[model samples]
Target: MEHPHPMKDFLVRAADLPWVPQGSSNVWFKPLRISPATGSWVNLLKVAKSGVVNRHRHLAEVEGWVVQGHWHYLEHDWQAEPGAYVYEPPGDVHTLVADVDDPDHPMLTLFSIHGPIEYMDETGEVAYVETAETKLRRYHDYCREQGIAPHEIVF
Candidate 1:
C-alpha cells in the first residue's frame, strides 16, 4: 500500500528536533510526520550514552533505523549506526545505551507503528507505560554528564 502525507514536505529536519524535549534528554524524540496522530510514524532520538532503559516491554512491534552512532540493548545490543535498521518483536524488554565515546551524536530514526506501545511493570505486569518522563529521570546521571536535564521521576 502507498501512504501519502497531507503535504509532501511533511518532514522534520534533524536540526529542528530538540536535543531534549522540555529539558528531558533521555527519551527526547521528534515525529517525522507534520501531524503525528496518524498511523504512520517516525522518531528522532538524543538518548543517553550509558544507562539502563529499565526492564519494560512494548506491545507494538517496534522497528528502528539508525541514522548516527549506535546503542546496546538486551538479547542484542543494537548498533544504531549511521545506516542500519533494527526490529524488535512485541514483549521485548531491554535497556538502551548510546555509544560510549561520543554522546553528542544524535540517533535519527524512523519508527513506523500501528499503535502506541505498551510497557511491562516491575512485576512483569503489562500496562500502558509512557517512557518519556520515566526514562529521563532514570538516567539523570548520564544525562548530566551529557549536559541534558534529567527526568522528574523513576518510571
Candidate 2:
C-alpha cells in the first residue's frame, strides 16, 4: 500500500540513530517527530534491545501500531507485532519495555501517536541525561566497529 503523504527522506542514517535503553532492561528508542501538517502526528522508533520506556502520559488521544518486535505496557503486556495495532487513550500510563540478548539484533517499531505525548520525568529533572546525542555517538561507534562507513552526525 502506498502512503499518501510526500515521503520525506530520512536524512539521518540508521547507524546514526544509536538505540539505548536506560537501565530499564532492553529498551532503545529512536524517536522521529512527525509533521503536524500530515494530519496525524507520528514517529518511528526502534525498540526491543533491552530497554524500558517507563510509564508516561500524553495530552492528546494517541494510537500506535507495532511494525515489528514486541512491547509491554501498563498492567498488560501487549505485543504489537509486525501487523498489530494498539490504541492508547490520552493520559494512560504506558510502560513500554523491550529487550534482546544480542545488541546486534534489535526489534523494529513504527509508532504513530496522535496529539502530543510528554515524558513524566520520574527523576524530577527537566530532561533525561542519556539522550539523542548519546545514542548518536553510540551508533557512530557501532557503525565504525561494523565496518559500515560512519554517517556524519547531522542535526
Candidate 3:
C-alpha cells in the first residue's frame, strides 16, 4: 500500500537547538520531533543534578535511549546508563531522577513518547498534564524567545 504523504526526513542537532527548562532548574529538554495526529514526539531530556525530575504516568508506551550519564526511577532499582535503552509500558507510574555522581557532566537521554504524561504529586495525586500540543507550544515559545526561526528546529 502507498502512503498519502511523502515521508519526511529531518535532522536536529542537539547543539543547534535551545534547551527548554522542564519545570525545574536542573531538568531541561530539547524537542526533536512532534506529531499532532497521533500525539507522538521525540525529545532529548537533560538533567544537571541528582534529583527527581517528575512523578508521572504514561497513557501510552514510551521508549528512551540514554545518551550520556545515567538516571533511575524511584520505583525501580535498575539504573539506565549511557547506551542503555529503556521502555515504559502504558499506565506505569514512576519518578525519574538523575544519577549525578559527578556534577561536571549532566545526564542526557533521547525519549520517544507516544502520548500525554500525567504529572503526579508525591502523594500520588494528579498535579498537571503535559500533552503534545503543550510541548509544541513550549518549543515555539522557546525558539521565539531565542530569536530562532521555528523552521530551524521544528518541522
Candidate 4:
C-alpha cells in the first residue's frame, strides 16, 4: 500500500517547472526526466516565434507529442499539431521549425530522446552536440541559479 521509493513517484505541475533558455531567442526547455545510465531524457520544448529551431540528427530514436500549437520539419511536408505524436528514427536529420503565427500562444511539445543530437549549421556542418550530460548540466545550473535543488526539479 505504501511505495518504498517515494522519490520515484514523479508528479509536478507543468506550470511550476522553470523553463530554461535553450541558447536561442524564443526557445526554452523544461527537462522532465533524465536517466544518466541510459543517456535518455524527457523534456518540454517551447518555441515562441516562427523560425528555424535547429537542424540535428539523432543517434538514437526520438519521440514527441505536441502539447500546444504546431510545428514541422522543413525537410518534411508533414506538420505536427496539438495531440499529434511524432517519431524520429535513428539517424534522421531535419530542421525543426515552429509555427508561431499566433504570437499569443507558443508551440509546446514533450520529447523523449534516447541519445545525443548532433546540431548542424546551414552548410550541414556539425556545429554542436547535445546529450543527456549536457542537459543535466543545464538543469543543475538553472536550479542553482533559481535557488531550487536539482532533485526538486529533476527525477
Task: Report the number of the highest-lDDT candidate.
Answer: 4
Candidate 1: clashing pairs of residues: 136-151, 137-151
lDDT, candidate 4, at 76: 98
Enumerate residue pairs that collide in model 2: 25-50, 25-51, 26-50, 26-51, 26-98, 27-50, 27-51, 50-99
TM-score of each prediction? 0.59, 0.53, 0.92, 0.88
User: How do all the candidates rank in terms of TM-score, highest first?
Assistant: 3, 4, 1, 2
- lDDT (Cα, tens digit) per residue for candidate 3, span 4-113: 98667887777777889889899899888888777988999989988997789999999999999988999998999999999999999999989887878899999999
lDDT for model 3 = 0.88
Residue-level lDDT of model 1, residues 66-128, one tens digit each, is 767667776573456767887878767765655645566654456554344555567767655
lDDT of 2 by residue, 41-106 (tens): 334566546667755665556666666666666557556556677777766766676644556656
lDDT of 4 by residue, 3-91 (tens): 78565576866677789889897999988888776889999999999987889999999999999999999899999999999999999
Which parts of model 1 have CA positions greater than 4 angstroms off? Answer: 1-9, 20-25, 34-40, 77-80, 106-108, 126-128, 131-155
List where candidate 3 sits over 4 angstroms from the true fold: 152-155
The residue pairs that clash in candidate 4, if any, are none
- Which is better, 1 or 2, measured by lDDT? 2
How well does model 1 score by local distance difference test? 0.53
